[model samples]
Target: MPIPDGPTTYRELAELLRGRIEGGEYPPGEKLPNIEELMETYELARQTVRAAINQLASEGLVRTVTRKGTYVQARLGRRRVRRNHVVTRSRAGMYIFPAAAYPDEPWQTHGTPHRSMEAAPEVVAEQFGVEVGSEVLRRRRVMSPEEEPPFQIVDTWLSPQAVADAPQIAEKSTGPGGYLERLEEAGHGPISWSEITRTRMPSAEEASLLQIPGVLPVMEMILVGRSGRTEDALEVTIRVIPGDRVELVADLVRDASAQWPLRTAEPKE
Candidate 1:
């Protein structure tokens, strides 16, 4: 592993193969060692190891099986909570409230209930700052996790006085307590949260609402949720998930002379 010399930058060979696949020295389903053996073991160029395996397959950490080659892709699990911490545990808690307050229960008569449809799309109305025809609410959800299968769809929107002070935000169940505790029990107290994530290609009604099958690719996750004392934007969700069972944890705190400027074009009028 001596490489590092003159001009090798694909973000420094993708941080030296992401520190040799996070130091297991490349393990998880293995494979990787092609592009002419990673340009003869990192002496570089084969377009810098194919731009460092396309930046580790755009950071989901590799997986490009065409004729079957670049492997290793299964390492993103730890995040049951915290990081924009919202917290919610029992008594059916995670925000699914309005099935006419559970009319004849049985998990609110087995599926399909949370509905508030309309207002979004203009890229979710500029990611929830709103005003592209106003009135946003579109709430649709579906999260089944114990032993899986309903995988998650979540559409969320809010802001009609945060759904008229939580008119049970249209109900569905799996979260009778957690959209930041029904946005602090409807007084709307979420402060500021962001999220953003990528990897798309999903609409045929979101590939049949996330049952996902064809070449499997969803992982979208927009999530905005703000408000604590006028940060404004109350909620915006979008989820979709199922990139082999979601795991998106972001904790970044490094500050060694922070400059971090990588702005791609958006202002040239």
Candidate 2:
């Protein structure tokens, strides 16, 4: 095959392959041409071809097996996680923690949370208004679709005051509605939440646990749960979700003064 017009750099090669994948030329689960074949066809070096494949892999478009070769990965539809702050209650009148947002999909926790009293990480300490390494309650839960690669890891850190007020929070199960309810019951009722979302490459441990390539970015949502009583944050929940698996959606409503359709100005020639 003649080399296509344009730059023959690895980035260009990646774009060409990306077009093929998106255009259905290389359907999901289909094996891509071997590096040698791609090198020959594109008249590029083996390293250039490999780099292109690596680019696609990083974008979650392909997976490279040790011996089998690279294959297009099946797209995992992104689950939309609403930014709604309203606390919800189940039909059984239990406060429901928003875990898996996918409706009708069976999602489960990987195992019982690993609960321990450990020094707070920098971020957690900041939220707790304590010096770094201050002892705090920590609970980590891995959530996933049944028999599937874990998609999210929720790490809940509670300030010393929160645990002192609601001891049940440190227990195996804070029955119905989870710890939020327990905290509320302990005079921390009417809890409010604020969140910050950022994306970064996953840590090695995170990549191994989520079963995703380190190149794939992950979103870290820092959720601070506070109350009216004091300025200190009561709890901080950090949600780590793979880039390919989840999307955050929030409804934005214009203020009363902002009209939907603006009046156009008259032409002044």
Candidate 3:
């Protein structure tokens, strides 16, 4: 193999490897070739190969074990389906629906809630467009899914008016229905919900709640729901989900090709 004349940036190498991995030539959980092998094959310096692998690892495309070699991390791809729902490409593309109607009881029957009637945090205040230190309805909950360990730890902050109107939220338990549903019932329909998904090693408290051993990475879903003119609304942060069990779905629609070229001007010449 011959090394290219110009400098070989890590981005270039990462793109090459990423293409191979996405193309299924290097399937998920498959160990990548050793550094020496990669250097020999690409005819690049060892440093270049290391840099490329580092880039991949940072992007969560690969994982490196102490004694073991580097292996591909399982990548999740989502397919849009319907409003607030998505078909995950993994798990054979299972459909995940949004939380339906408010619940009459707590999501988990075993635990208590932590509630505070105080000023919201800066982040929360900014999101809700309220002044810092303004009174807000704050509740923290640890919810278990079925027999599984506590699957999610949610910290929810709602506008004072939003909560006062729904008295059920005054308790430390989950509302009779999901919080979002309750918001809808209060006449604040969500114009959009933005989700930021990632995985990280859980904190000590999170690990204890989830009852998992070691530093197993857990999936985090942060959602900000906005109402009114698709520009603003209440924001909520929910974190920690068992990676193997939780699924996220989204649906998208586009005008069909038949609708293209709506009107063509007549030939003037």
Candidate 4:
């Protein structure tokens, strides 16, 4: 068999394949040619074809399955992330609730939390109202979406006392409602929480974990959850969300029943 001259560079091959996928030549969910087939058809080197497919994967345009083949990636739905749930906007904010970001249907992503003991960082200590370098429980969790690769990472720091009281918090999954529910059971029902948000390019390690393109920026949120009027926060949560499908919201309303924190203040001149 004779091979026709084709694009010589991986970039050129990637562009050609990208055009075909986007132009419906390959179609969504359609299996792309294997490495050998791609190399034979394009008359390109094996490395060149592999590199091209990898490029497409990085762009979220295709997915490769083990023992199977690479297929065109379907458009992914954006996840909802209520900024309010992440943190309260004002002092009057009472009660902390989990941000319901996804549909009521079974959640697609499950998180595996890794726990360890570490000295509290400056920021974390300030939020927890503890001395810097105080011991704390650090829980790092990475989440995977169903049938897709991992896309999010989270970190939660708690006062060592809190963890000691709720040993289940150290488990990878703390049953339904997760850590928050466990905390509540341990007598740390959060009355309120606050958050700060930042957006920036991912670190090399973060980019690798999330499998996001270098150009894509991620949202970093710092959330502090408190119970009653205690100056010591029960936990501080940090969420790293990649991609654009997220919303942050906070509601500041005074509850008539009870108020330990977020006191009403007089207007200043």
Listed in order, each prediction's TM-score against the native is 0.29, 0.75, 0.43, 0.54
Q: On residues 1-269, what C-alpha lDDT tens digit does candidate 2 reach at each position?
A: 84668439999999989999999999988999999888888788888988888888889888676688888877777877775666677786675555437555788797677999888889999888899998889999899888676889988999999989999999988887788888888888788887788899888878767766667799898889897567569999988988888777878888866776875779999
RMSD of 4: 9.7
User: Which sections of candidate 2 miss by over 4 Å?
Assistant: 1-7, 16-50, 63-72, 80-83, 97-100, 103-105, 133-135, 146-148, 260-269
Q: What TM value does model 1 have?
A: 0.29
Candidate 3 residues lying further than 4 Å off, grouped into runs, are 1-110, 117-126, 129-136, 164-168, 171-187, 190-192, 229-231, 244-269
Clashing pairs in 2: none
Q: Give the TM-score of candidate 2.
A: 0.75
Number of the predicted model whose lDDT against the real structure is largest: 2
> If both were scored by lDDT, which would come out higher, candidate 3 or candidate 4?
4
Query: Which scores higher on lDDT, 2 or 3?
Result: 2
Cα RMSD (Å) between model 3 and the true structure?
Answer: 10.2
Candidate with best TM-score: 2
Candidate 1 vs candidate 2: the TM-score winner is 2
Q: How many residue pairs clash in each candidate at the backbone level?
A: 10, 0, 12, 4
Per-residue lDDT of model 1, residues 175-238, tens digit only: 5455567667566565466667787666666655544433457667676767786676777777
**Local accuracy of candidate 3 as per-residue lDDT tens digits, 52-138:** 887777555776665677788666432222235432222433222344212232356237777888677666787777898888877
Better of 1 and 4 by TM-score: 4
